[model samples]
Target: MKLFLIGYRGTGKTMIAKILATAWNCEWADSDGEIERRSGKSIAQIFSQDGEASFRKLEIEVVRDLATGPHKVVSLGGGAVMGTENRTTIAAQGLTCWLQATPATIAQRLEQDSATKSQRPDLTPLGGLEEIQTVLDQRFSVYQSCADFEFDTEGKSPNQVADEILVTVAKEQKMNS
Candidate 1:
């Protein structure tokens, strides 16, 4: 089955997904990267030029495509779960892990990652931690609704998170079997 990483922008979904893919010997697909590849434009460009609505439409299409594909480690864009269809697809298609962190952690992480800042468009005009909290408040319920498991990414390295996911999955499988 597909293993999906769902979380806010700075929650290390991409990093953890890569680690999981490598450790599991499977392909890894990132929703944002795939959107960029398909559109021939960066996500920020898409948002600035075409608008968030258009970008979200594209996100739904990408999620649908990936949801129907074979097993792999998939990292979804931060806002992909905003769409009901996308959330449904994820819930039906994969084992989802919600990588969570505090608003302060998210703000700090984003501040540290210049490349990520360049690629993403601001969702709101609020500053720093306030913006993070605003976005989290809007999406936290959706993330929880679709996730089969939750992984805390705060103060954890990508390798550490990956190891935890592996152990958790093993335990789940052991229980289910």
Candidate 2:
């Protein structure tokens, strides 16, 4: 089964997906990493050189390729599902789960993770909590509208999120089985 993990910039989607994939014996696909690999540049460099529109086109291609492929857990970029076509493609073929975090929480996490921020094209623009809040306020409705399940993860760790996903996956498996 394919599951699409979506959330804001600093949410633990990647870490959780990696752990959950290991725990569940599933293949893991990180959309941003894939996009960077396919594009041959860091996302920050991509945004600097090619801009958001170009990066998003690459994001769309990565998402489409991933969402249509074999069953795997895919951690999507923050803006991946902004496009209706991307949302429709994911929703049509897989379950989309939203990992929710407050803008404060995201800023806190981002500030602590300089290495991650160095590679993240989207996070570099934000100065701090206020900037993050503004962006979150702008995009949150879209994130909510696209998700099939929403899980609040403000104070949670990677293991906690993975546990929650594992439980949900088990329940879904049982129901479907």
Candidate 3:
């Protein structure tokens, strides 16, 4: 099954997906990257030029296409789980691991990431920590509902988080077997 990483931006989903894919010797795809590749535009550009509805349309298509393919790791965009159709599709397609972090931590990480400002768009008029907290509060329950597994990314490196995911997934597999 596909291993889908779902979480807020800057929660290390993309990094952990890379680590997990490397450990599993499988391919990995970043939904945001795929969206950008298909549209020939950055996420920020998509949001600003085409609008969020347009971006969501692309996101849904990308998620569905990725779900039907080989067993790979996918790092989904933060708000990808907000749509009912997206949540249902994800649930039916693969295992979802929620990579979580406090709003402060996410804000800090986003600030540190050089590409974030250029690639991603601000979801609210309140930018920085305030925006992060507001969005996280809105998405908390949705993320919880969609997650098959959850990991707090605070005080941990990407590899460390990936290690925890590997252990949990192995136990889950063993139990299922």
Candidate 4:
């Protein structure tokens, strides 16, 4: 079955997805990277030139395409779960795992990932930690609603998170069976 990772930008979804993909020996897709490759532009470029609505349109298309496929692991854009259609698609297509982290941790992680700053656009008038806080506050409930389960990335390595994900998925399967 497909496994989808849903979470905020700095929540280690991408890193953990890579680990899970290797361990499971399955293909993995990153929604933002797919959009950038398909559109021949970075995500920030998409947001700056075409606007967030347009970028989100592209995101929806990518998400839908990936969701319907046999991909082993999929990491979605931070805002991907905000749309009802996207949430519905994920819920039906795979096990949705939320990789969560506090705003403070997110801010620190973002600060370290300089390349990501250029690729991801800002969503708030308030920049820095304030921006992360504001966006997380608005999106927390939406993330919670879409996720079948959560894994906090705070104080955890990507490998550790990947291990936890495997355990959780196995547990979920056992419960369902």
Best by lDDT: 3
- lDDT digits (tens) for residues 1-177 of candidate 3: 789999999999998999999999999999999999999999999999999999999999999998887889999999999988889998998899999999889989999999989998999999999999999999999999999999999999999999999999989989999
The residue-by-residue lDDT of candidate 4 on 62-163, one tens digit each, is 999998866589999899999888988899999999999988999999899977678878888898899988999899999988888899999999999999
Candidate with more favorable, higher TM-score: 2 or 4: 4
lDDT of each: 0.91, 0.85, 0.94, 0.91
- Runs in model 1 deviating more than 4 A are none
RMSD of 1: 1.0
Error of 2 at 53 (Å): 1.0
lDDT comparing candidate 4 with the true structure: 0.91
Point out where model 4 deviates above 4 Å.
Answer: none
TM-score of each: 0.96, 0.92, 0.98, 0.97
lDDT of 1 by residue, 1-177 (tens): 798899999999999999999998888999999999999999999999999999999999998997776779999999998899998888888789999999999999999998867788889999689999999999989999989999998898999999999999879879988
- Name model 3 segments beyond 4 Å from true: none
How many angstroms is residue 152 displaced in model 2 relative to the true structure, after the best TM-score fit?
1.5
lDDT of 4 at 6: 94
Clashes of each: 0, 0, 0, 0
